[model samples]
Target: MNLDLLLEQVRSTSLLEWIAVTFGVSEVLLAKRNKVWLYPTGIISICCGAIVLIQAKLYAETILNAYYLGMSIYGWIKWKSRNQFGTPKITSSDSMDKVKTWGIVLIGWVVLYLFLINFTDSDVPIIDSLVSSTAWAGMWLLANRKVENWIWLNISNAIAIPLLFYKGLFMFGLLTVFLFVIAVLGYFDWRKILKEENNELQSV
Candidate 1:
């Protein structure tokens, strides 16, 4: 893409896209810091993102964002239920939770893939469904502060970067790059926190 054309595209960007990108960045950074505010920020981002994806004819993505809105609210409530110390509890997923997480991913992928193929004109149904389903599973894990959420989220971010770029959504594509890096850092940060918490429990 030409520099002038890219600049023109940026200038022509809609308010919703800008809002989505802004809140999206805030949400990821807050997540990295283990802040409770991430959910509300995510809700705002998803609301803007839903409109933008709808306008772009990305029906799967639009529906995913709508789901994200609900997930964000649920995550907020769940995260608010802190431990005795009034801190949000974090944990690693056990074997059963891991199995259930992957199961959700598989089922969501199939359902969305069929929905997109049968009901919509999505040109990239496979990628769309993959991203949406994995993200759904990731959000579920994230609500409970499971360490594996970062892994699944990064998977979605990696796919979303190229997908958004191909769709001419350069801003969101760049945002995904930022999200990808942050999620990696988040994994390490949360892992360290979990380890320290475990150590404290053992000492007690």
Candidate 2:
């Protein structure tokens, strides 16, 4: 793709895709900063993504995005709920939560892969399932404001970048790279926030 052709495609991009990308970028940046606004922004991004993926016949991705929609709503509710003392703080996943996250990845991968192999005519079932499953687990952790969500999300982003480029989606590949960097930063930032929260608790 030459520079002129890429610019043409950018100009030709659907309004919905532009909206999706715009909200998606905002969502990730807010998430990196541990802002509650990410969920609402992400809900819009995920909805637009699902519509775009459905039009492209990417059924698995569409479903994954629908899952994100539900999780985003759930996350929004969870994030907004505060106790009387108003102390809903950032935290790391406990041992049980860690086990559940891994379980989601492994089982989700198998179920999605089998669904694709048995039902859909998808050409890239394995990698697609891996990416979606990891993201599914990551979204679950993110809904609960877990620090490890960034780790799981980045795993999906790393796999997805090459896959998107392989499918000739250079724009999406670049977007995933941006997301990968933000997730790395979000991980460390969350760790720092978690430490501060723990210290604050200790002082009381």
Candidate 3:
């Protein structure tokens, strides 16, 4: 990679892409800390990202970001709900929940793949749909405070990093790498929390 060219690319990044990157990073960091503010930050990020992706002709990514915006709102409300202990709770997903979540991913991938293939001029429809579907399932699990969300999110990040870089969205690619690390940390953190919660309940 040419240093001068990389610097030029950085300098030439659009305002919307900058906003998307900024808030997207914030969203992941906040979520790692189990903060409620992640949802609003994510909403801002994806809205900006949608516009940037549309301009880049990543139509499936654009639609994925739109879905992200809606899921952000749903996540916000869901996370705000209180348990009987009058606190927000994080929990591990049950076996059946895991099965159902992956089922959604499979169905979503096929549907998105067909839609992008027929409706858009996307050159990487399969990869785009795979990323989008996994992300959609991950977002749903995250909203419900399921620890398995990190696994799904990491899968999406792995696929998206190369795709974003290939599309010349270097900044977004780097951001996704950052997000992948955060998701790994978040998985362990949430698992610890679940263990503590279980211990507390058992002692009662």
lDDT for position 166 in model 3: 91
Ranked by TM-score, the better of candidates 1 and 2 is: 1
lDDT of all predictions, in order shown? 0.90, 0.87, 0.91
Cα lDDT for residue 127, candidate 2: 90
Model 2 C-alpha lDDT per residue in residues 1-204, reported as the tens digit of each score? 799988876776678887888899999999998888999899988988777766655666777898899999999898899898684677788999999999999999999989989998888899988999999999999999889999999999999888877765555667789999999999999999999888988999
Where does candidate 1 have its weakest 10-residue lDDT segment? 81-90
lDDT of 1 by residue, 7-79 (tens): 9879978888999999999999999999999998889899988888987778888888887888888889988
| Model 1 error, position 201 (Å) | 0.7
Query: Model 2 RMSD to the real structure?
Result: 1.5
Q: Which lDDT tens digits does candidate 3 get at residues 63-163?
A: 88888888899889888888788656788889988888989799999999999989889999999999999999899899889999999999999999999
TM per prediction: 0.95, 0.94, 0.96
Model 2's TM-score against the true structure: 0.94
For model 3 the local lDDT of residue 152 reads: 97
Q: What's the residue-level lDDT of 178 in candidate 2?
A: 93
Model 3 whole-model lDDT (C-alpha atoms): 0.91
Distance from true location, Cα of 183 in model 1, Å: 0.5
